[model samples]
Target: MTTSEDTLESHEVGLAAPPGEPLQTLTAAEADGLELVHQWFPAPLTVRDGSFALPPEPAWRAVVHAARRHLEAMVGAVGRLECPELGPLTQCGSAWLIRPDVAVTNRHTILSLLDDVQRGARTLRVNLSAEADGSAVLHCPVTRVLYIDPIHDLAFLRVKQRGAPQVGLVVVDSIVTANPVAVIGFPSHAEGGYAEPEYQQIFGDGWFDREGRGFKRISLGRLVSTSDTLLEHDCTTLGGSSGGVIVDLVRGSVIGLNFGESRDRRVNLGVPGWVVQQRLAQLEGSI
Candidate 1:
């Protein structure tokens, strides 16, 4: 809730949440709750970039706890193949789900699994864990798949899992010049994944135009260079967070999908929400 314009790295060092809480799983009931909460706000929350600046000790611990709790309900939606059985594999370099009810992730994540399958990997498995404790659950079947951009690497999957809580879909919205934004996802390095969020204020906010909406990456710092981008405090994202929601906190809506980060490891790039809308619409049509 703090607002600042500083880019500081907030490290998440802690234990993960357990996966036993039925309430943590995405469900219709939870979706209703989110809708109710959205109605209370006039606009979605806009995210900006800045360090969370934990006050040291337990407070930082609380932050880490919150992040782990969030991840507990998230399930990894992986690709499957039948030629050979390689058992279940994790998107070791990807993030968890944005909404638990429906497991969504960067299309490339699933694609990567497919790549492995073509290379003689067997059985694509979706990773699901309990929300209360980080208990590992086996193969959560994927019932549906929705891709926003065949080329852009965005996809949403309808998975079948027991005890998932009701979840509301985060819809993308129209863009405005210099709008505020926030991202909620698990990021990580090649070494491993982190449960914390990677928050970056679009120093300047922009969106994907209709023609250019396919698969594109927008640089957060570049926006700041072009226009005004509002940022928030203490948000840092790591690996294993692909396909998480980049929300308009002020507007209470989603603005983009977390795809990748900067090479220097500073700015975070997000795919605009409008593009997500287009892809979702395509999904609905195909369905």
Candidate 2:
């Protein structure tokens, strides 16, 4: 009994005794749960990022199908905001849903209309369409300003609706240049001062045709460069294209928003998604 007691004490202290002694190490299950320590030196290791391959037709098909579903949801989330006159006047810029009832858009879209709303003119009604059979069309009013970027041309508004299908914002520490992106939104055909729209005829403004998910246009472009404070690109766009989502297809999320374009419509600028994420944090209570 005394010898057995001594062995027990030694084992408790992580030690082994004489012959027939158990090893001074963890059991198989315990060792399996612990990972071996990895040592690193400053100069040996290099970064190797893993990426997916969708080369095969089946693989790419699944990718496109998923992206299309999100795109259609985005169309339902977008709404046409017109300056509330006796009747709907000129069509303003676009906005996409970030939250169920809250959306982000260009600051210019709501700035001029702010005065009218303040003086009890009328709420800015956002017209959203259904995704099936044109079953219903919703006109939600922007009841509050959520957030606005200081230097970037972006704004967030809360609509008076319980919920709406939304596209998620892809947040990342840094944006790599020359990454391919999809500029998804409803673009206008007008160039000479008016929004002479060409894409909204079949589906109407700010909607997706439920019949075949028709009328949603996507412009392919790549990140040109990230200059000091702006994200530049060479995507062709029109006036009504402002506030459209800049989607990163491979990541399957919105990396930024196309808010402006160069005079030639070649060098477009977008508000990066990181900026939007930061602004949302500041709007916690401002609701």
TM-score of 2: 0.62
RMSD, candidate 2, Å:
23.5
Using TM-score, give the best candidate's number: 2
Scored by CA lDDT, what does every candidate get? Answer: 0.36, 0.51
Q: How would you encode candidate 2's per-residue C-alpha lDDT over 1-287 as one tens digit per residue?
A: 00000012112333221233222243666333322210110110000111112223453346444565444444556655544563524445566777766778877666656667768775666555422234455667778766655456778888775454444344453665535565655444332333234223212333333222222245445565554345665444455556767776566567786776533323567777877777777886666
On residues 1-287, what C-alpha lDDT tens digit does candidate 1 reach at each position?
A: 11111112111112121232232122578446534432331111111121122223353334333443232221222211111243222332232334453555665555545545445543333443311123344445555544424454456666555564435445646644344344443232221122222122211122211221111111111121111121111233334445555544334455566554433323444556666666666666555
TM-score, candidate 1, is 0.48
**How do all models score by TM-score?**
0.48, 0.62
- Deviation from native of the Cα of residue 59 in model 1, angstroms: 14
Q: What is the lDDT of residue 233 in candidate 2?
A: 56
